[model samples]
Target: MATDGPNLASTYEYVIVGGGIGGITLAARLHARLPEASILVLEAGSDPSTHELATSASTVSAVRSNADLTWQLPIEPCKGLGNRSSIAQVGKGLSGSGAVNSAAWTRGPACDYDLWAHSVGDQGWSYESLLPYFKATECVRGMKINEDHHGYEGLIHVVPVKANWAKRTYPLRKAVQEAWAQSGVDYIEDGNAGDPLGLTELVEAWDEGKRQLPSKSFDLEGVDIVTDTLVHRVTFTQDQGHEPRAKGVELISGQHINATKEVIVSAGVYHTPKILILSGIGDPQTLVAHSIPLVHGNPEVGNNLRDHLSVALTWKLKHPEIGLALGSPLLTDPSYANGAPLDFIQFGRVPTNLHTEMLLTSKEDKALVLRPKACHTESILLYTYMGPHMSGVNVPMDGTYITTVTANLAPTSRGHVSIHSKDPQQPPKIDVNANDTEVDRHILREGLRNISKVLHETPSGQSFIDSQVPPEGYPVLLPDSKDEAYDVRIRDFGFTLDHPMGTAAMGKVVDASCRVIGVNGLRVVDASVFPVPIAAHIQVAVYALAARAADLIAKEQ
Candidate 1:
């Protein structure tokens, strides 16, 4: 129920801030593990299952501009993007970003999680340790699930794109596959098998033609959910012989709810660290500047922020009937060949020659170089116009355009999320130093060129392309341009794919179990705790992390 004013219950065994995927999942798991424990979940937004803008799968468009469903938080003017500022579309309701995001379910390469485990000095954070949780969280449907690699009974249902799901045949599907094959990328049988290399059919968190938001899928029966309650800061109790403990959370209404055992912060990438800093658990200088007393001095709380930067290339289709639009019947039918539409995604590394040149020439770029064994770029085929509307480019609404969204999955340019004011309601200042390093620009340039080659140079891809509609001043073909021209074009068109992570980093701010380093009874379980950004869409990782976190918390209890 919606809890407002000062009448909130004073005590609970656990208090979770932000009822997003992480919070809701943790609460459900906690309830399952500790049947009698009283759990409280405070959400800043309304419950997603009942919210008007959150009910429909097509609400992805409305959620971006709807203030009631999203934070619509703006970032500081990024110097890398020609001093341009952009709004971060973060879901505000119980389901969080999962409710509004394109339900593409992707688990990145095994090495990505292995690297995280090594970086954090925790074997529990390794891929093998997290695999069970990953399997347990997904109930594979429609697609062929490798029995050894997938679970039969899970909370979220994963649906693969079937031919019947297409309103009409994606005339270019075969051509695109042929193009990727021509470009030397192999077809991956399963993208969720910890090896997301080459071309693969897109998997989504869908069931019966509807998006399964975590708030609706997971069971939160035993948890006391308090909606429309903004947690101002975490309340702490310091004992002379022990580390400071999180006693409870103070609401924006000045009401305090006690957490007898522990408090967990799952307020997402930006707000997670923002709450920590507001609670005096961040950099001492920041707390002092806000005239807030310091509880713990963790300078890394709001630092080391990272996100996937994407660039779009749109092409006019020769046949409009072959393309899928937003309201196509093929998209909303579960009985369709697969369950969803628009499959086909490719993950590849930038050319070795460019990698070598960057390593030899620039120190900054050298640090940002894509590891030879790692996949640094993701190219996904879309049957509809997919460029960011904020880019000032008019996307064709006549349904004759197809776009290729290429993203720098492994970006080296680190940014941060810092609080601008002491008010908890004020959004954090986000600075995702996108395209700052030469390596990022170089990767995007190569990625754009690679996709262009697949769609234009290859025989099958070229057969379907009627014409191209590049942004103003952008080169007709990226590969033909000089490095300077490519860099300018990248800076002009680059935008966030909304996969942000590493603000309250694991190795730095929290432990392997996601417990905050210098505090007792306070842990962070969300995207903010990731040591680095994963190569895949983050929702899958968040599910695995939350499941693991729930197990860890249960063991400790």
Candidate 2:
């Protein structure tokens, strides 16, 4: 809803910036607990509930390409990816990335959250501690959900692709499963139970084929939602002999909205730190460079940025009818071949000979290398068309190609997000620094090699593959190509899985309760508060985190 002058003049008990997944969820939870409390939400983009692209489950491409629904931010040229600059697509509306993402509702392994809790020295953040919240956010449908693992009463609906639909759409489902089994990968009964080691049908946050946006799923009754508004910076006040307390927020229009109780910043990874930096709550050096006076010297505000660096390997299908062509009604499952369940995406591995060779050639630090205890690589098969549409090859209508996207799940390489100027309208400088370390490159190279091997050597995989279709401007690596060739290929084609996080990290920028360090009455509740990147699709985690944050905030109040 549009905000008027009168709305801006009124003060609220709680002010939430960004109206995205975390912000909306927190607002709904707070309202449910304290029905008399007044809450205000400021969103930079239009409401996704009314937008067609945001609500359509089949229009995945449209959500990514639509300029109006996404913040078309560009990353700074990275030496890791051959000094190439690429667009970082962050959602711009009320639903945020949840509205635009591929709708894969897989929660990562339990070990990932346990590791996170250990890293931050907080038992409350552990998987077991947060399991109730995870269950509280979703109502599983269309499948027999384990009562011990899933919730029966929740707003968001989670469901598996129907068996009839999967059978009709994926003619090669059985063959693919057999092929994966032949390659030594087992079938996971349910990926969400936290053991995602094998092939499992993906559950999506969809109801009746329509995207269930977080904004719509969460009840926003009695909440004042201000859409098409940009939050310039948070306002803070310091009384005599008292700590600096957050007053509210100032808009780009120079209007002030007062928050009598607290201000919660949930502007996402890229913009959450951007807002904090703009408010002078960043590194003193960065603030001085941008002529922004330092309010607090939290050097870790925008550092430790992490994301899944991915490269796609495409192949031509000999039997087009077996592929997900003709706008298939369902996409069955994606599997992880050889890695821990904590690894975010599904992946396949190469033969033992190639695997040994790749490991022998590696010269990275032993600590950085992924061992059996830690997950390094991840992969997932895409049945539908991928790559540039203008290339004329691998078109959805043509039904000739399938793609496998491989990635480094637990990357040691780190980057930062900083502002060039004090203007919030200008996008932040996001440098993921992908493949900056030898270990990251090694993992990605091996991942690509393994996926290629599965498609070429496996009986079921080979039966469907006619040939490999390299994207234009990419070199086709021979089966006997050197390891350097695979490295070069990864550098040339790598992109983010679009899961950017760990900017305002926990235990550094914020405390265990998500309250910002060195500040009172202000908190950051979003992916930015993640101390480390969780190895999975992040939406489910975000929902669970927000649910936990709401409880913490409510208890303290």
Candidate 3:
């Protein structure tokens, strides 16, 4: 069962590389549709069932830190980010990042999808076109859900912060809501229901409190799941004046598996492009630089990389005995031990126009950001002192502080995922240009300023926040802080939100059908194919996307 896929057939109907979320989910659905078809899934990571730390929210860092379970790739220094280098890591297990990420099941605004369709020149990628797939993927049980937009019959279960029966509450739940409202952000019933702006209850892809692994949730009972197997590159059968046809994949260990029908690559953002490039199907210049033989030359294969970047503000609470933070007596209760600590996520545009700000953004990118119903910022309220610390504020083991990590959801800064070697075993060169554009910097600065104003001036804020832990040389923020101060802060300490995509974008590399251009019998179905940045945590979108890809693949057959 481990060696042979679907049967003992030497050639499979579908050969899937990287048994991560997208690969596993697609295989499960395809198997359900065509029970007799031969499908092979190759994963370079361990089986998630044996990964003990993947079940709960508390061990997320432990899972990511486990070298055996994750690919901790070093990022190249970005000049835009004050020349600071950071890590770009993701899960290497069968479930991939879905097994390691904080399981927030959020769907970005409908406009995000609509804009993607417009950019990619395909109506099928629109929100209305993809709505059925979204409904097909989730069994939403939130308290205030609109039945018209949610589905009760799906594999993954979604629960909002105001969930009726889940029986869990945070100490700062009500206060945090009131404080954000005091800052003029309104309440929205369901953020997943097309409208993503304003403050909304936090939601998660949860089972009571346990994390849901995609490899387990989608039901791949009889499918062959090969683990710890690295795919080196795709072997193709090509002829002159014809698109190269993918024959099969060659493993890094020099083992080759034949694919009779198609080869699907879902190795994710960081590694997917590396596989394509290693297959000699990328930019001519890059191939020449790495001394790889060129089969198909497309410059966009590993370009246009983007991710969510954030700057966090830490607030020292007045009363530690109240037990509002983590490490408090409140966590002793079993209900509080599961899922994420925060209760709500606040999203909105920058408070003011950037007329006074310096020149920023390409004309096309700027228009989409300023478009109607597109949110530019997301503020995550962590119930503990999880610091993106500028001052490096340290507290006791007691609960005395909380953090707000406000991220630029629609960043204009673009980076690339390039390779310096011909070997796929070596990780790709990842350069994330954080806070590079003036537009990105302006949005983040104003977002921090807005939240800071809320905690510093609002009546509700006075109830909970004692004071902000300041950066060095400043006793307080606002009056002392300047444009250069925050710019310096962002360059010094801005961190990636760990959501990377668009390396193999739809409009550039693949068509709307997810088929790679200038090649046949090869498709990429993963977050790397996302043409634009979706403004929410990508967990829900990825699950729903694989469902869409499976449907498209099945219909073609």
Query: lDDT ranking from best to worst?
Result: 3, 1, 2
Task: Flag regions of model 3 displaced more than 4 Å.
Answer: 1-9, 142-144, 164-166, 323-327, 351-363, 387-391, 473-475
Q: Compared with the true structure, what per-residue lDDT tens digits does model 1 show for residues 18-90?
A: 8888998999998899999999888888766766556554556776678888888888889998888989998
Q: Write model 3 residue lDDT over 1-557, tens digit each, in one string.
A: 45423223457889999888889888998888878888889988877666678887778768877887788999998898878787877988788998888888888999988888898898877788888888888888655378778888888888886883256677677787898888788999788888979998888886777888888788787677788788899999988888899999988777788998899999999999999999998999999998988988999988888888888777888876654555567777776756777888888887446662335446658555778788888987777777433325566546787777888898888888989788677889888877878888877877777788778878888898888886565445562368777776666668888899898999789888889998999999899999989998987777777888888888898
User: Clash number for every model?
Assistant: 4, 4, 0
Task: Tally clashes: model 2.
Answer: 4
Q: What would the per-residue lDDT of candidate 2 be over residues 1-557, giving only the tens digit for each residue?
A: 34532356459999999888899899998888888888888999887777877776667677888998899999999899899888988888888898888777877777677777876788999888988988998888766767888887988888665422432335555666766677677777677786666666767776655788888778787888888889999999988888789998999988888999999999999999999999989999999998987778889999989898988777788987655555433333322211111112353322323454455443322322333334556677766567553222444555677777777776767889999789889999899998897667767887777667667778887888887777666566545567898887777778888888789999899999999999899999999998767767788899989888988888887
Q: Pull out the clashing pairs in model 2.
A: 344-535, 346-379, 347-379, 350-450
The lDDT of model 2 is: 0.77
Candidate 3: give the clashing pairs.
none
RMSD of candidate 1 to the true fold? 2.8
lDDT of 3 at 446: 75
Candidate 3 weakest ten by summed lDDT = 1-10
lDDT of the candidates, in the order given? 0.81, 0.77, 0.81
**Per-candidate alpha-carbon RMSD to the true structure:** 2.8, 4.8, 2.3
Please provide TM-scores, in order, for all candidate models, with all chains considered together. 0.94, 0.90, 0.95
Question: Distance (Å) between predicted and true CA of 512, model 2?
Answer: 0.9
Judging by TM-score, tell me the better candidate of 1 and 3: 3
